[model samples]
Target chain A: MSALLELSSVTRRFGGLRAVSDVTLSVPQGEVLGLIGPNGAGKTTLVNVITGVHPASAGKVRFAGEDITRVRPYQAARRGIARTFQIVQPFPGMTVLENVAAAAMFAGGLSYGQRARDEALQHLRFVGLAEVANSNAAALTLAMRKRLEFAKGLAMRPKLLLLDEVNAGLNAAEVDQALELIRAIAARGVTVLIIEHLMKVVLSLCSRIAVLHHGELIAAGAPQAIIEDPRVIQAYLGKRYARAQAGAHG
Target chain B: MKRDASIALVLFALVALLPLSGEAYWMRLGTTMLMYGVLAMSWNFIGGMAGYPSFAVAAFFGLGAYAGAVAQKFGVPMGFAWVGAGLLALVFAALLGVALLRLRGHYFAIASLVVAEVLRELVNSMTGLTGGGMGLNLPIPAMASVDAQARFFFYVMLLLAAVTFTAMLITANSKLGFGLRCIQQNESAADMLGVDTTFYKVSAFMLSGVFVGVAGAVYASWVYYIEPPDVFDVLYSVKAIVMVLLGGAGSMFGPLVGAAAFLSLEELVWRNYLEVHTGVLGLMIVLLVLFLPKGLISLSQRLGRRGKLR
Candidate 1:
């Protein structure tokens, strides 16, 4: 199948440092691709580049065969690309549903305020947050806040959704619930490129995994093959050392 | 929301009936109160809804006055002159909003303040058209008497206030209002969610300017005089902002409530202790900000919730 999103030699630079460099990747339509990496792997920056928060320094980004390297953030959203921030940035003063409805206003060719709110309610229900729809976004717990972010991104009705560490800070049960939500989202035929830290989620949730190390794609394959790759092991040496420390104490 | 709209409709009708009472002094105060209330409501579009904290109200107000007066002097009909003034202010505001709305928070507030002051200085220097520091006297269109003239301008301001109120209500549920509230809470997130922040901000700026400008036009014609310091007074912007804040910035009825309370307090202070009128107003604002951070509307909402609970 043709890719829904294709990045060709994309590079992002912050002054002297290369945050993302020559990263060419693609996600086929109706696929779940997990992006796994250590700290400062430029995973978030790569998503930023795709979502138009940061301009690409080199190369091009294509969505469904159209060049979108210079697209503005709102234009990217309007063109059916949506992203969630690693740090949840809900509209603090607005109710949780209003936050979702605000994003939903631009969905499916500009719905009226009431219709948009109605559509947003469906996304909130999908994320299991209909109960706290009237509560201010700031009052949500961390897990609920992540669900809110998920609902907001989904409200855009995106063909491609980029999730940034959505499973972070969740308890074991919450993580399982989130994985189910992600699975349900992908089942709707939407392409998903998710950045995740949890190896358990990376293995089970994603059909294919891409590993980034120091702004470069170290490996891209099935989850089991990526886990078995020595390059992936060497790239995660710091993580291995930390794991070794935990093991010795136990 | 329904309660707020009903209250607004009642207010519109009652204010429209004010001139019928035939009490000239009370009618005049009523006109001033409604005029200032419109300013508060107009300012709320930017400061309250969009969270821009703009001080460009005085600049547009002054520009509108000058445009209307100049048009009137050049043989435009008196009513049409106000429209000319509104259009002039609208164009100026769109340009200024584009340039100045880039700054956020305190920087934006201070920048807008300086822009108004600059417009004031520019108006002062253009003596030939504006009559400069000497000021310009408007030729009161052949009204029957002083009361008649007062009645004419009173009706005009009353119309502007009603329009502004209706506009506020419409905007409260409109997509623009939703976008603006999003921008106010988190601009970047709003942008990511497909809100054109720049367009929403500038549109609010222009919308705020049009009403305030028309109000200035009406005020100029009412007094039959215009001056740099008087028309472009920073206090006009300050009072408008304070009224919005005191009432509850985003709530539909907040501006009217704020304007009524503020105007009554001002009149009381001005009548009893004219010398310290400003000092008392300043103190009241300080206390209001400290005690009621979300303004008087929050208090009413809390009370209403208790009533429902009971």
Candidate 2:
């Protein structure tokens, strides 16, 4: 009914450099909000703050109506916030099933053994990785590895998932599959605040797109409106795209 | 599963009947093997499964030996003395693990190494309680023959090895093992996934201390004396690490295989090249690091995979 995640003027600073400034944002329950930004735009830092990987230097993070500003990362996971690393944190030597199972055990504490294995298998199947369940996680192709990372996040059964570039490095067909999986996830009542780069995917899947540039949110509106914002075009989208838009409009 | 159970039974029968030849030398060797097995297996819990390269084995072992020795002198039965030693080591581990487990990789390894060496110094300096470097003696059973005493200690060591091995097997299958493996792979990821990494690591440390400390106590009584230099020797810690690394650090049978390989290698070197035993062993360890970096277990696993391929 309310926002699943609320970042009120959230700021993350590394020394004097604010990676993410006082950027207030919220993702309503069951909505798929897209975050678009250029390099060093603090999309990852914002996700880090929400996932409790980095403590907010200022402001508050209210999730599910509870303030979780200072909660530890693991504690945040326990309270149903999950994330996929942009760089794909590989659990070397673990089987794909075991990787998912580790998340299931941590997220659900599924009394271990068979029940946990079953749950992990289910997640692997959902991520289209059931065939390579027993294969070492490192053995997966880059595309499958991305899916594995996403599946691991899904295994947590979080109310809100912070997917960082899940579609990155994916082929056209793979991206389509990923989009379908994300839509299915939202249908299952899980809220998604995705930091995606593919504008096509963002425009197609997201109900609203938020533009961040230089650690600040410059524009937030429907996908169509966000692409039209002059500030968004100036910072993120090149001047060429703005000129093309102006020429097409004239 | 049935085949595995039968194999375990055969292994059990082999160990239980082993030393029936009445040879005192073999009995002594068996005792040493089982004792080291217990130590290595204990280390495997923290080092192998938990992925913490702990160098505190000798500290716990020496502490256990002294605790048991003190209790024995105070008129406590030797059996209860071992239990007291285990409990003392457990408490020490619980406290030490909390602080030391924070250090990772080489920092953790060095810090743990220092704990044992520091304890050795304290034991050497504290003459009133631990007899300083002079050592403590155990009251030998007056009527017992050397053969009978050897057999008695051999069985005691076997019991200890069996207990530690069983515990290792149990942990290797539990959520603790899963959590440990996760931690071993990635501590931050494990924590992010909601694993209580600190709790598991510290628990593994304490588990290691309990068995190793108890084994040390039994060893003290069996040997009839324990000097701080001998019981708290860094060589003991090195041997345990070598054994675990040689066999397969994390698996249930790794330490057993390693202890056997290490002790056998020691015997071969000591008997055949007494003048250069340590040098030869050091060279062998170097070769082992270069070649069998994953230890002998990886070889076995490779062979098993080959068999599956067939």
lDDT of 1 by residue, A33-100 (tens): 99988999999999999989897999999998999999889889988998988899999999998999
Q: lDDT tens string, model 1, B65-89?
A: 8888878878888889898888888
* Model 2: per-residue Cα lDDT at residue B63: 92
- Position B54, candidate 2: lDDT: 90
Complex DockQ, candidate 1: 0.75
Instruction: Tell me the docking grade of candidate 1.
Output: medium
Taken over the whole model, the C-alpha lDDT of each candidate is 0.88, 0.88
Worst 10 residues of 1 chain A by lDDT: A237-246
lDDT (C-alpha) at residue A14 in model 2: 99
Worst 10 residues of 1 chain B by lDDT: B1-10
lDDT for each residue of candidate 2 in A1-250, tens digit (9 for 90 to 100): 6888888999999999999999988889999999998999999989888878898999999999999999888889888998888878869889999999888888765767888889999999988999999999999998899888878888888898888998888899999988898888888888888999888789888999999998999989998788888898888888897788679778
- RMSD (Cα, Å) for all candidates, in order, is 2.7, 2.1
Error of 1 at B228 (Å): 0.6
